[model samples]
Target: NQTKMFDEKKLDINDEKYSSFGAVLTDDNNFYFTSARNTARKTYGANEQPYLDMYMATYNADGSFSEPTPISDINTKWHDGPAAVTADGNTMYFSGESFKESKQFERDKDNNLKLGQIYLFKATKTDGKWGNIQPLPLNDKTYSTGNPAISADGKTLYFVSNRPGGQGGNDIWKVEVKGNNTYGEPQNLGDKVNTPGNDNFPYLTTEGKLYFSSDGRKGFGALDIFVIDLAKGTEAKNVGLPVNSGQDDFAFSFNDSKEIGFFSSNRTGVDQLYSATPICGVEAIVMVRDANTGKPLASAKVAILDERNNVIETRTADTNGKVTYSVDCDRAYTIQASMSGYENNSFPIAKTHGGEVNVMADLRPIVEIVKEIEVVLNDIFFEFDKSNITKEAAFELDKLVEAMNNNPEMVIMVKAHTDNRGSAQYNMNLSNKRAKATVQYVISKGIA
Candidate 1:
């Protein structure tokens, strides 16, 4: 199972003042982080030294990140840092301090910050552009919410808060999406995962593994990244070494395979980004086509069946008349291709390791037309009342010759027709002359 690969790089922040944290990868391989480089005055000012802000940077396919650019709309003069991106790379959820000056650190009876709230903003792609932001309903003024973590499906959100009713100082809470742009009430993750100490910065991998930073257990530093199998138990274990050094290691996200992840660390004397690569299995690709013409046919469907004929992966061909899919090559599969007007085809494929095999199966159309039949012109017409053959008459006669040559055994009687506008004897004479001319043209072309 050690087939997956991962590589890490330390993202460079060209500016000397700001530091990077909470690095997440997008489907396009771009990375997003938070920083506090040049925030001094705006809608509100920060009481702390570093007024943080979120930023985005693109990562080239060669595993390098571009210079960071501040997401100014979401960033403000107040503290804002550590963002979590959805797997699709469209939505963003992050933690930030209130940007309003009139309400600075106002606390309720429970001493929770009334203005600080965990905010969720959606970024949609319209005409290949992204810039719209909307707030989520789970944010409340009674408590301070930050350190957001979203599930791979974008249906569940997890964050840390110091509101009321928690196992410790900052307990992890979850909000499930109820419908379009709506979410249910926030619920605590319960004692199985939370401790009396602070538990925050939750990161969920595609495989359902949970990674977060906590100081509950004896660790190397103040906050250490821990992994917990939520399905089994929440007893967290440190993701040792290069990933977690003696300092704070939080804000981690993984690809679908759960083998590789990106996390931030200050062990290098600066809060930088690093990646962990684990062995991941490769997915398979398959295609189908028309055997005779080599032309792609749309609406064709393909299915992969196991030894017991149980369907495994089924997909329909896209508009390009091809279907591409990825499947773990763990077992032998019987590939089947079928369409409504074509005969079905099937072949067996043996599983192999880490290689792309093009299994293209061509299907034959069931009701096909043969190309051996010859069709001939049965009649030729005379112009008006004249008996002379016209140029157009030669054109029709030449086609008859071509048909006869295409089918050697074909024979035809060329008949000439005349409109009944003339006298019977004159009409008969004109028809006779036209038929003779047609026969002469056919014979000239070497057709019998």
Candidate 2:
């Protein structure tokens, strides 16, 4: 059935003792996930729970996963799981509990572990073999950073951290890669993407859509995955169940199509894997223009809304003076076009098909003239004191020709005038000559 895409499947390796959390897909069709499986056997294992370790499992094209293998180089005795892989599969970013010897003194005011830190590692292909891992430079002593979502260009990084001076809890932060291997200081994404409640596990799509899990708002339970349109403001919306059952559905990753993604969830009794399929449809196109002059306006802004006045898209007209957009069909779209120097134009358009449809709208400029003033210059003039008609005079005469061509019935009086530096009679003779020269230029340019 089509609904098979939303079906949840229990991962085979999970036993009663271990917990599985964040998971990601590698380029070679192998899956990488964080697990606390075998690490529970070590002495001083803290609470005897599994310390997170990185594991890889081969995935068949038809959607079956083989047995997982532990990645030895980066995993350690302390907790190290919750991982994100870059698109090229050459780099990884993940969170880990610190293995510092002075761990007892690393507790915060609430007596929680303060030594956890995020680490960046690079993997290079050498002589047909994957090379050893190298750590990134930004690891600091104070704040713990993890859960990275690298932008499609691999230039910007988004991660989660509970460092001091945040709104509260673990806030989402980002850092832009300044150079080939250097990154700038991390900055909080602010109240839009962060909350007083814990916000973590950021997954960005190739199209710049951000998906993350949070328990901040009312949800199924624990951490529920929410989708936020990064282009529009940072408003978040719960993805809803059965994808987000009353359990933690965090650490999500998606393929390029965005139609499918994998998330670790405890909804089915254990923190296993679940897949999701997105509902698909074509979007409608809306175009706005200036109705009076038929001229496209660059500064015109458009707001498309539904019957409930909910904004579907808010876009500004391009330099061609048109705003092109797509929305689902059969919905009532309230379109409002406004510019600072023009009156606002508001109307409603009902889309029927999911194809190209043009909406012609024109806005009038603010200046009002009681009577139309027409200035017709039929003659050309010399520049400064020369008697020859310059190119500027020819340009003005071309406009007169254009007006006559556009309005066949319009008649204009061609008045030729000249400065009185010469005798009045001489000036009149010069003006007549300039007027004849202007008409000859227009005719030569094929302006009827």
Best by TM-score: 2
Per-residue alpha-carbon lDDT of model 1 for 1-448, expressed as tens digits?
A: 2223334555554344445678777777667777656545432344333566777888676666787777766665556667777777766776665444335345666865454554445445555455565555655566667788888889998888877889887888888866567888889988766789988889887667788888786667877777787765646777665566688777777765424578777776656666776433334455677889877767788877777667777788876667654556466677777665565667677776533456776766644321334343424556676767564455445455545564567666656778878789988888888778777777888876
Residue 238, candidate 2: Cα error in Å is 1.5
Give the residue spans of candidate 1 off by over 4 A.
Answer: 1-9, 13-17, 39-50, 100-125, 128-132, 257-259, 268-270, 279-448
Give candidate 2's error at residue 27 in angstroms.
3.7
Q: Write the per-residue lDDT of candidate 2 for residues 90-154, one digit (tens) a residue.
A: 76666655443234224565756454455545455455344455545555556666777888787
Regions more than 4 Å wrong, model 2: 1-17, 43-47, 100-135, 179-181, 282-448
Give lDDT per model, in order: 0.67, 0.67
Error of 1 at 146 (Å): 1.6
